[model samples]
Target: MVQTVISVAGASADCPEWVLIDLQGSLETRHPVPLSGRFVGDLHFTQKDVPILIIGHHILYGKTVHLEKPFAVLVKKERSADTSMETDQNVSGTSYHVKALIRRKLLFKTRPKPIISNVPKKL
Candidate 1:
């Protein structure tokens, strides 16, 4: 499956080209990644493999948000070298298998959850 990584995009007039991102642990949301900086210019974002262009006062600063494929190596480390060779069991011999194989991808924009208001309204 694919993974997410938040990277810096553009710079401000008074500040150098830099951005700070904090992936809040255990609180992952697919919403437009929250941004906090000196000057947050007007933004146009979507949930797709598209570049995130930061426009400041009509100037388009182009930068693409990237995604990574999750991976794992069957190789044993140097200190634990030959460990893999020692095990003659194939993947099927063990309980190892592909968890998921994503062929078709679909992304639907979810609506905000409704909430009940405590304040009474006019009849």
Candidate 2:
């Protein structure tokens, strides 16, 4: 039987960059629904590379921090092969591959502020 070994991808320039964003708070939905693949907000950067997050009518400011221990995003891959023709035994196994590494994170610990429009009233 062929054995497959799973390991994290070495840190290299070819690896895709990944960043973890911490809101420092819990997210709540209106009707307690799943939030997978949902549109949350837009993240913008200032001239000094400071991160600004805009969610609905609230705006939050955050900073990037390096993690002490990096995290690896992995993907599972399965393979099936017939090991013996007489016995017709199938060899199936799964291996994980590192997709990306999270070395830094954007942290928004402070409370979000409301975005006010500065529109002038006409007489």
Candidate 3:
């Protein structure tokens, strides 16, 4: 019988804090383009510790929610299996490591409102 072996990567030394943002409505762009590395919006906190997200001319009210269970972000580790000398032991498969841990999220469930007043050029 043939068997497959999978290897697991080690945990990250520094577990960065990760927060999930839940938007009720979908974002529609004028043109179909990649949103990666693009400045989406600004997140501000009120005196009561509420979250407000301002994108374009729309403003969304949100609140912070604590997750019941935390999530771990995993990243695949790249390694070369080639060796100068062949050995009886075989190399393990690719592995992944925990990049970050998420314990909280910002939830925006209400509909966004258009900004009627003048917005500041810079915050």
Candidate 4:
């Protein structure tokens, strides 16, 4: 019997996929989604509203959990991850900064999606 489910990764292109749920109230994944009790407990207790793969007995739904970061924040975070240099930039009259946040309870980390902003910058 499974009491909880936690998904570390396996989302593709922001698309929804189907999964299988067992009669034991446990979610099943084809690729063994870290079902260890310790891991799931840590994740559930720590990460608020973490994306989980639900394999129901008759229904499967694909869902994703976001860190509540704005689109601009995600872009800036990725740009900063690429380098060790200062991420503060003053383009045109706006200011941009990048920051990385790690959950203190879960060992797994989530990075923002890589986005290429088409906004023209002042040369």
Candidate 5:
């Protein structure tokens, strides 16, 4: 199994701040990741791994506006063939086995906001 990171940046002038992301992987995995800055949401990879982050914008007054901060999602790959066996004895004398593995972290940053004009005009 292989891990991949997807980084999205905000667009330039007159561009849309909202974006829809469709992620496809080797395991036939399909995930929809919406980009906004309003309310936060969670990105679920497969059935077990889910990354939590804030949404970028909100649809209010029939319009979509950007939020103050940006958001991101992280995904890691896990293999079924890679397994480990462990035995644990409890008070009931029952044996419990489990598998342990490590996953890497992915980081995504938001685009910088455009500067506005604040100069005064002289007549």
Candidate 6:
């Protein structure tokens, strides 16, 4: 298996959507990676509670992991894979910035139904 590294550019709320990722200066090839779930790791204070994807052998979150910088990460494809290359180094000393993107609002309308009732009234 070939090893590849990609920087986490951003994430989309819609599942099964193609997220944009920058491959850190390497432009020889491109591939579509289907992301099913978020990445798992002991994230730093900046990375906590953020959405991420598991690419190649690293758990990438935010834009904290630079495209041209080298960082240590856990190397495993499946949950049963041997996690021996795992390390405790994160995008060292990098601060995280959270930005919220606005999405189109969904408006739903329902038709009013006629009311029919039968009741006895006392005078």
Give all candidates' CA lDDT scores. Answer: 0.32, 0.80, 0.77, 0.31, 0.29, 0.32
Highest lDDT: which candidate? 2
Give the higher-TM-score candidate: 3 or 6.
Answer: 3
Q: What lDDT score goes with residue 76 in model 6?
A: 29
Residue-wise C-alpha lDDT for candidate 3, range 1-123, written one tens digit per residue: 222333333554556889999999887678998877777899999999999999998999999999999888777654456641352334334446677888999999999998886766764
Where model 4 places Cα greater than 4 Å from the true spot, the runs are 1-56, 69-123
Candidate 4 structure lDDT:
0.31
TM per prediction: 0.17, 0.66, 0.70, 0.14, 0.18, 0.17
- Candidate 2 regions exceeding 4 Å error are 1-5, 9-13, 76-95, 116-123
Sort the predicted structures by lDDT, highest score first: 2, 3, 6, 1, 4, 5
Cα lDDT of model 6 by residue, 1-123, tens digit: 333332332562332222234333222224465444634233333435343433333444444222232222322233222343453234232233223222221111222122333546531
Residue 87 lDDT, candidate 1, scale 0-100: 51
TM-score winner: 3
Per-residue lDDT of candidate 4, residues 1-123 (tens digit)? 212222223443342333221122343566866767632211122165443332222222223333344222111223334442553343222223422222222112232233345668842
Ranking by TM-score: 3, 2, 5, 1, 6, 4
Candidate 2 scores a C-alpha RMSD against the true structure in Å of: 5.6
- Model 4: ten consecutive residues of lowest lDDT: 98-107
Tell me the tens digit of each residue's lDDT in model 5 across 8-120.
33332322333333222111113555434533333434344333232222111111223335433333333233231231222122222222211233222333233343657
Error of 3 at 18 (Å): 1.8
Measured with C-alpha atoms, the lDDT of residue 79 in candidate 5 is 22
lDDT of 5 at 23: 22
